[model samples]
Target chain A: MREKIIEKILESGMEFVSGEELSKQLGVSRAAIWKHIKALREEGYNIESVNRKGYRLAERPSDLLASNNICHELDTDIIGKKVISFETIDSTNDYAKQIATNENEGTTIVSEEQTSGRGRLGRHWHSKSHEGIWMSIILKPNIVPYKAPFITLIAGASIAKALNTLGVNTKIKWPNDVIVNGKKICGILTELSAEIERINYVVLGIGINVKTMEFSSEIENIATSLYKEGYNLSRVDVVKAIIKEFETLYFDYIHKNSKLETLKVCRNYSAIIGKKIYILQGEDRELVKCIDINEDGNLIVEKDNGSIKEIVSGEVSIRGEKGYV
Target chain B: MREKIIEKILESGMEFVSGEELSKQLGVSRAAIWKHIKALREEGYNIESVNRKGYRLAERPSDLLASNNICHELDTDIIGKKVISFETIDSTNDYAKQIATNENEGTTIVSEEQTSGRGRLGRHWHSKSHEGIWMSIILKPNIVPYKAPFITLIAGASIAKALNTLGVNTKIKWPNDVIVNGKKICGILTELSAEIERINYVVLGIGINVKTMEFSSEIENIATSLYKEGYNLSRVDVVKAIIKEFETLYFDYIHKNSKLETLKVCRNYSAIIGKKIYILQGEDRELVKCIDINEDGNLIVEKDNGSIKEIVSGEVSIRGEKGYV
Candidate 1:
């Protein structure tokens, strides 16, 4: 009821809705209309009020992520059916996992800022307040646990495609990092809680530096935001596009068992394919020629000795820094 | 210091230690010693106090899973280096995952009773108070997430071997269930929190019906306790042996990259290696003859048409229930 009233005020633009008129349209008491307007003003909403003119919504907190705002632009069916938005959180991934068992699949948790955001390999992710898209999508795909590693690729491909649609040329560095001009603009952390044979839930934690202008000293060289790269983009638009792209790719992979679309996106936006890359395993680093991404999403590369082997992501991590390239 | 005092009392058996003696041994004042004793008694430890004879450890509560008791007979270097014991918890698997990041690789969490015990396929596991081994082991192996499915087989093999050593005659029923006398006696629920590349932690939840005399009607036909099956094993002893056996097999698989011992134990103690079984998918069931346990712990089976195919545990579940050979 409150949201509907707010929506009405927002749609009214500069025109004021009289209390009697709002009550007649909404089928609520005039006191309820007055109460909702006061609450909206308390929530940082700019409302102009007059004795006879009633209420007019001056402005809204655009930084806040409401489900209506996200769903209004959403095109997917399941990815964002229910959005739990927070102004500040410890980590969206942690919160999603905590509630994944009880919540329906495709439920999502998003935050303006994550106080202790995390990345792959236990790295620290910097999520600037209201500047980056810090979100975790809960997926309960009816696929085996072993098939889950490919979902990471699906997420990467979706992210790359979504950003590309917005005229930001983003490349994917398999198997999870999304790069823009050789620097990481986005990272996907896919965490699974599964039994031996079945997947209970998968928490896909995605962090995109949309408008972050600066980063900490340690990651300044490796991390760059969309705004820093001279693209002023709305975090909400990035989120909506990613979710829209992700749902299509995810359904194709899960329902149809087709990796053609994902593979196409990965190969087209690949940052390392056909380039010389280094594979890091423990303290050992070996340079290998990137050939092609195999059907199973493993990296098939030819060693300097003219031998070819598929490098599984779980067995080894790839690190091709700027100097190496 | 408190644990040491309790240990001293436990080791003394029937002998009583004077307050002054306890204070001298613990390097605390007599008043502090008395306070500690009161706290220990409040934790359900039965301590007897005589006027001049001082405090004698009358009995140790059997329900509490003290780290000292679990580690007393522990022989392996890892797997149970640090034990977190709880009297009652929602679920050991849930709690283990909560603390897995900060704890060491081989840290363990054990509870006397799980209020809401869970099993494979989201079934309810009957965990009666003081009558079952409800525990979860945290493993941080340096293996990729794809190789983690085999870890479940390793856990099942270790548990079967451990119980066989105690003359329980337990057999593994593929993947995760440990059966005795044609009924399930233990279940291994392996949950992994991982990325596409590396595993953050694997929570191996093992539940053994140690001395349960009665079960709920729904599970009574399918579940059997060690005590009901005429093996009155001690829960602590079972826990220690399983951890010791698991440590050896886990290290062999992770460090040495050897699944030979695990495969040998699994094949030898398999419940359906040579039997006709039914594979249960969502709504499809197919009958196949189990031929052999392959090198990777997958079930190699032959259909009636003489077509041979390897059955991966993650793809479909096996269900060769009663009245089926």
Candidate 2:
């Protein structure tokens, strides 16, 4: 009832609707409407009321992450059909995995903060309170387990393209990271539960630093955020754009088996192509030149000995010539 | 305490041990010893009491699947360190996955019956009560996810070698099936929880029809049990031998990064190596001649046009010339 009342006020376009009119429209008593208005105010919605007038939605809470706020006008068919918003969580991916068997594909889990965020390869991800987009999407693609690694590339391309669409220039750092100005801004962790021939579920966890300005000394040299890079954007807009872009690319690849658009975005907006990089494998490091990503999404590189090599995504890590990119 | 009492009785080697001696040796009262003996008898152990002599072990219940019976003189360091036995379960793989994160690498879960056993590619497996070995082993190998499909081959190799060692001629069907006389006697289902770069755990489910004399009409043509095939082996011996053989092959692969032994067993005792088989993909079938298994455990086949092609395990299913293998 409260959301319906808020929706009515929002649809009225800042014009005050009389209480009797609202009661007639929403099929509620005038007293019930007043009570809902009061509750909405307490929830940080600045609803304004005047004498001989009724409620008008003056402003919405910018910091609050609610389903209504994120899914208000989101234009996506499947990516964010059901948005589960949280104030804080241990990890969105952990929560998604717990309900993955019961939830439908494209069920999105978002939180304002994560107490124990996780990165790729069992690394700790620094997710402070309300400073970034800590989210996970439960996907049940009808593909085999061998085809799951490419979803991470689709997510990377989506994030980079979404930020660029929002006027914040970003580039994809190969398989699963999004970077801006040669600094890391996003990371994707893809986990799978599968049998030998089929995939049960995939939890695609994405963490993007949006409003974070301060970083610990350990990661300050490499880690960055959109706000720190002087591009201020709202989290809701960024998430909506990403979902829209992801749905298009994801559906194209899964339904049609076409990687053209994602490959185009990845190649055009890549940060490491034609650059000197170091491939790190445990205690061994080798200098290699970035070539191009093949149709199978594997990285093609040229070694210093003038030999070409194709690198699969999960086998090693790549870095810029001097530092992390 | 009950298991210890049974161990003591078995160690006596058909001799009787008095209650007074058992109390002194095990530091329990005679009444407590008597109570444990009574409980053990209720659990289907055969113990004979003679006048003036204590209790002598007559026989063990062959139908019962307990840790003490399966682990009796089981020579393995890492495969069966912890054995959890159940009378009934939905699926041993499901139970193993539930405790996989908290349990050790080689913790094993076994059940006498599975109400809802599963096979590869979301197929249903029929596991009758008290007639088969329905078991799953949880392993946390420090290998990447791409290398996980070969573990299914390792398990198949182990089952074939163990059955061969017991004087029953069996052959491995390339990846994850064991057959006797060109009919499947065992099936393996390997499930993995993994990230892109590392494996979290693998639930290796093995179902061997040991004493089944009947099968549903749907699968009777392609499925047979060891007893039906005239082997007539005890379930206890089969389980112990498979565990011992699995421990050796698993350690060699994960520790030494060697696929030599597993590939050797798979090739030497293969059922489809020199036969014409049909590779089924959805509704399409192509007849191909089996050439060999490569070092990576992929099947090599020769097409009708004399062209050689490599087939990965999970991408397609292989069948005998006319029916399921």
Candidate 3:
């Protein structure tokens, strides 16, 4: 009844609706309708007063997190049916992996705080409350185990397109992170389970600092959040964009006569091109000039010995030749 | 006191140590020593005795498992220094992965049975209770993440040599399993946690059926155990050989400079050599011939159109021309 009451208000463009009509339509007391309107206001939805006429919806908050205000606003039906929220955890990645085995495909998990959230190469990712998006999406693709790495590339491109849709120009760093102004804004950690011939599921963990107030001194130079870049973009908007892009990329990669056109998107958005960098090959990090990403998505690096070393996605660390990142 | 009793018995060359001396040396009652001797006998230790004389060792049942019997007989000062025993578990590989994080290096986990024992690709490995040597070794090797795959090859060669020491002629099935008479006798599952430049730890799980009994009909055609192969072997002996060989291989691959030499061992031992196999490349399964393994330990499979595909260590299932496993 409360949902219908709000839906009617939203459908009416926040115009005044009689309290008696709301009560009669919802089969509830007028006082109950007033209480729900107050709750909606607390969720950052402005419910205007019109005395005896009714309540009018005025405005929504700038940041749309997974609160009651945003869940009702979602347009898609399947991807995020049950939105689970957490206050704090050791890792969103670890928690997502724990429940991935039994959950249905498209189940979504979000955490407000992560104590030991991590990125690739065992690096810590700062996830403060409401300042970042710590989330994982469960996907069970009917693919083989060997085809798993390509999904990482797809995830990177999906995030890149999502940011692009939001009018935020960002570059992809090969396999999974998104960089803006040469600093990392988002990280995609793709973990999967599979048999030799069939994949059971894949949990794509995406962590982004939407309203970055600060970063630890160690990473202050390398990490940049959306808020730090002069944006208080609603988390809800980012989530919707990400889901929409993932749906398109996943369909293209899995169903079409596919070379995974998403791979081309990644190469197009790659930020490592034409840069002098160090390719951490073994214990001895080799200096290499960035050339191009080969067709199979290997980062082709030309070394000093006139030898070209192509690096596929593993624990690769890209850095400027002289300065530390 | 029982351990001391067994030690004395072993050192005395199967001669019966007097019950009084055994009690005095072990600081136990004569009756207590007699109780232990009886327990040892129940565990398949052949004890020789006379009136008022303590037990003397004759022979041990070669079960090829880790137990107080042979763990007490081990000669190493480092590897297998500590052992944890489980009757059954989901997967020895899973259990071993936990052990690597729990204990220090050189720890060995032995399971008398693995109810849900698994090989690579989560395939069910038939580990009948007390019929097989199912265990995992935890090691903190000083190696990089890229070099981590080589550990699989090292453990494979070591197990093949260990089975040879027990007079079982087993061949290495490249990438993982050990085969006898064209059937899998043992399989090695190697998992690692690492940074780009350093490995945190590695858990190597080796599952082999000591007695060929209790194998299911489904696995009968493709699997063989030691006892059915007519080898009077003990699980403890196989564990010792594997641990000894692993330490040697770990030293060479980590301490010495032969990562290429170690990787070459994979091509030599794998079943893919001179065979046509299906390489699962993303969405399409390609029919390719195994030409050679490149220096990076990736399989160089030549596709029909003159292009070559480098198959990384993923879900690789080798098959003949027929559309079957």
A-chain TM-score of every model: 0.87, 0.89, 0.81
| Chain A vs. native, model 2, TM-score | 0.89
Top TM-score hit: 2
Indicate whether candidate 2 or candidate 3 has the larger DockQ.
2
Q: State the lDDT of candidate 3 residue by residue for B35-80, as single tens digits.
A: 9889867756678888766567767555524345546667775678
lDDT of 1 by residue, B1-325 (tens): 6678788887778998888888898899999989988998887788899998898878666545777778775777878988988779999998998999899999998888899999877888888778899999999988888899888999999899999998998888887688988888888888888777788899999999988888889778878899999997778888888998998999999999999999999889988988989988779989888899899888999999999999888787788844322
- Model 3 in CAPRI terms: which quality? incorrect
Model 1 has an lDDT value of: 0.86
The lDDT of model 3 is 0.72
Q: What does DockQ give for each predicted structure?
A: 0.63, 0.73, 0.14
Give the lDDT of residue B167 in candidate 2: 96
Worst 10 contiguous positions by lDDT, candidate 3 chain A? A61-70
Q: Best-fitting candidate, measured by DockQ?
A: 2
lDDT of 2 by residue, B1-325 (tens): 8877887888887899888889999999999999999988987889888877998789877667777788777888988878998879999999999999999998898888899999877789988878999999999999888888889999999999999999999988878789998889998999999998889999999999999999989889989999999998888889989999999999999999999999999999988899999998989999999999999999999999999999998888888896765
Q: Judged by lDDT, which candidate is best?
A: 2
Give per-residue lDDT, candidate 1, residue A290: 93
The best-first sequence of candidates by DockQ reads 2, 1, 3
What TM-score fits each model?
Answer: 0.86, 0.91, 0.76
